[model samples]
Target: MNGSVFSSCLEASLQGQAILNDNGEFLFVNRAFCEHVGYTKEELLLLSIESFVIYEANEDLMKKEPIIKRGMQQKQVEKLILHGNGYLQTTLFTVTDVSDLNQGYYHVQLDKIVTTFDDVDFSMLESKLRDRDEVRLPKKILDGIKDTIITIRLDGQFLYANEAAEKLFNRSMEELLSNDFWTYLKQNNDEELLSKFYQLLAGEEYTQFEVYKKDQDEWFDVRAYRSDDQVTLYFINISNRKKMEKELKESEMNYRSLVEKSPETISVHNGKEIIYINPAGKKLFGIRSFSEGALNLSEIVVAQDQARMRENYRMLLTGKKEMTNSVYTLKRLDGKKFDAEATTTLITFKGKPAFRTILKDLSERKKVDDLIRKSDKLSVVAQLAAGVAHEIRNPLTTVKGFLQLFQKEQEVKPFYLSLVMEELERVEAIIYEYLTLAKPNVESVFSKIDIQVLLEQILTLTKAQSNMNNVTLEFEYEQVPAIYGLEKQLKQVFINLLRNAIEALTDKGTIHVRILKHPDNQVCIQVEDNGCGIPSERIDRLGEPFYSTKEKGTGLGLMVCYKIIEHHNGVLNIYSEAGKGTTLEVILPASN
Candidate 1:
């Protein structure tokens, strides 16, 4: 080959190589080298090698005088240079003598071995150089990261720790590096974590584990990635999330305990399918265990109520209505019926839509209510007896007087006449009671009655009794709707209530009667007395027949009053506090 051909081949091979004289000035560089460093051929020739040493590493390179002396004597040297964009690069050069005796001229040949001219493109070479520069970059970048990053050796010793790691562990990087990484763990004695760490050191690529930080005494989730011989651990504090989970578990447990302990039957269901049931529910349904599919809500609910239950479910699912509290009649497993009050709510169970219901058995309450009803009936019967007595006593008195006058002759047998009069008086009293019970002519005289006037008349009639007891009578009447009823029957009711109030008062006690219209447009007559009130236990029995507190009370008085009020389509409500007072309120619907 010709000399020109050889020169061209050599020059092409040195395209990315560069050389610099011992004076720190670039003497020659191939086209590829000039472009890789982001400089033109002329610019490379003018530039000094030290200019590309990177400002920070320049002093270190200057201190190494042996490297410069060796390169000058041997005519070959290898050194790292900083590119224009602050990157380090490795370069090899072959230098020639350029002393003054040689007429200020020099010749040199250079090459790049690690990054060859053909293999190293300008962009790729720059990128590789940048990566090398980054290896020596300061750790300030890690300070801005939120997550804690730590590097540990195979011996469980911390090699490096970032600012976040320092804050989280409450230790300085120097302190962390000096201590064993396990020593900073709150539960350093935990065998499980140690085992996991052992597994991690045994070449396990990625592993997740929980460790407690001693500084905060809180748990953290650590995800580790192992590369080469070092392990990189990323830590995230999840204490708050764990605490919330614990609280939710406790709340659920408390709710379950309440359901299990309650006397009322309770069950949770999704529509007609039962998802969960309490012990009470099982007992109420006569089920041995809820595990049996037969004990589901669909099976327990009566056929008649099924449709209604489905409708309610539809309403709840569609968001048109919410689960409501309601009273419903349920059929028991034995085919008997019972009343229940159910409170329902929408809930998510096991990540699926569901409804929970709490049921309360109302059987005992119903029984008590029935007893009250019976007592009311007896009260009415007693009122009728009193009314009969009032109507028949007058005729009985006339008969007795006439018989006494007839017996005045003394000619007839005195014993027989006396016996006949006695029997006649007894028969007349019985007839009087019968008349009262019949309530004859009471309802027949229906008329619009002013409650205010009626109350006043009753008060007038009881004035003598009030005076005997030294009780003061007071009246508070408001303009109210008139009530249609038998005036005489109503009068009797008012009299009975007023008399009871007056009798209860001690000396100087007050009796107050109030007349007003209720919210339902009904007349309300309230007679209150400041006297010794009945005990709570005895109040329920007040309207029953033959139940009385007074020694002379026949128990028929209040009963008679209750009957008359009922006949007039009214209700009597009584309120009393022991040693305080008693109040009676009579409510009658307004006349059309």
Candidate 2:
């Protein structure tokens, strides 16, 4: 046969099977091939078989060479063809020898055309047919696919869904197709998402998005790809990932709030430098934003406390100490100082080693501590005063006795005797004031004393002095509970407070005293004055012996008053403000 006749015969015999050249350009295709791919014979010749397959499946077509080589060597190749309408078709090809006839001077014709389907069994034939049919059938392919696949129109209308998709959405394919795809998704009703969906229908492709199914009410991660006029989506449930992210955010917020509102100053330091500081720490350090290496721990601490702070930091860094809670003085940037109790611990912050310290301000506590020490010193002074007064009393008595004897003998002049007597009286007064500083016997002599009456008696004695000082004294008394105490001591306590009040008042100032019963069945006597009041700074030291503001003042008056009132099981409270006034309140338990 001629070459054209052989080519036509070979093409007509294979039915739907085709042939291709070495470059994969179609050489010839039979009528069956044209009908299977929805192309005419003339058109099929112009288009390569590779163009009919999907773009992603083009690689599979290129793999046909190896099979063709094997077939040429073994004489046959059975292959699957990808249909233009998105399917695979199995076909068989048989190679033949069509070598030219050229023997030096002339040509040697060794033409051969062979065809065989005898080796193809019925089962193999059936598999080929099935592969062809199944290629165009998505349901069959979807059932075999591992990932869940769903097809939707441009309007997000479900068209086709796989078994995995059906199971994940907890809905049948019919149900999914009946409703809008976004209706089942979480937050689909949100205005922003609804607008986005409209935009998606308007030719926008949503790549990887988060969606939720209506039936199961669960979330998924969806990846959508556009093909033709439809969108193919692949979904993966990511509820666990979403939940973890939410929990992490909440935990971070809680920790941040705790650090911000803590009463103590909190700071996070990387090595020797501060990285983060809380509000209290910022105020304590007198600066903001202490970034890396900006300020060292020693620089912020007071000079006297630097050694202790350094030691604590060293121990923390070396792991010799797990945590530290120590008190030290912290200096402000402005040079003001405050006592601080700092607690420190090692921590890792943002991939770097760091320490977190909490510092509590102890300035008010230090003031109280100083007062306690001063009070202790005053107690010693009181004891010394008592001893000196006792020692000097004997000498004063002997001197008075000798002066009187000399005056009677007429050896001493009258004026000298009078001067000696005046000196002796002054010495005696000093002894009396010193004796009041001695510790009082607290054992109560159980005698019911009308507190109002005792207060009136002391007030009458001080009225004459108040008039001399141009101070008006007023007293208010109510029927109050009586207390059992030494009458003489109680009177002395009243006199001492009254004298202090009178001295504190300027000319024409008023002194007010009120005696009443407290809610706890205790007797309360309050002495208030309108005078140049004590300063807050000096008020705490008012009761210490020998610590006086007045130059000629003994300062033992309030101290002795404190001792006497304490012996009577009473509490003394002094409230004063500079330029305001002063109030002294004494509370004593009532007798049963």
lDDT of 1 by residue, 257-324 (tens): 88789887777677757777888887877767656234556556655455445545655787845766
Off by over 4 Å in 2: 1-77, 81-148, 153-160, 167-170, 174-194, 198-206, 211-217, 227-230, 245-253, 287-299, 302-311, 375-592
* Candidate 2 structure lDDT: 0.68
User: Which candidate's TM-score is highest?
Assistant: 1
Question: Positional deviation of 348 in candidate 1, in angstroms?
Answer: 4.2
| Position 349, candidate 1: lDDT | 84
What tens-digit string does per-residue lDDT give for candidate 2 at 1-592?
6879866875675355556654334567767666655567776566544443322233453444533221243245444545443334444545432223531111111122232234547444433432342332344445566567887666566766777877876788667767766776543444433554564567766666777555466678867777666677787777788888889999999998999888778888864677888877887778855565677766776544554465566668877568988787777888787778889999999997888888888887879988987879988677886856755666577677767888789697677667667757767655676766654564655689988888878887888999999999888888887788899888888887888788878889999999876644677789999888888788779887667766546576778888887666566778787899999888787776
Tell me how far the alpha carbon of residue 341 in candidate 1 is from the true structure, in angstroms, after superposition. 3.3
How far does residue 305 in candidate 1 sit from its true spot (Å)? Answer: 1.5
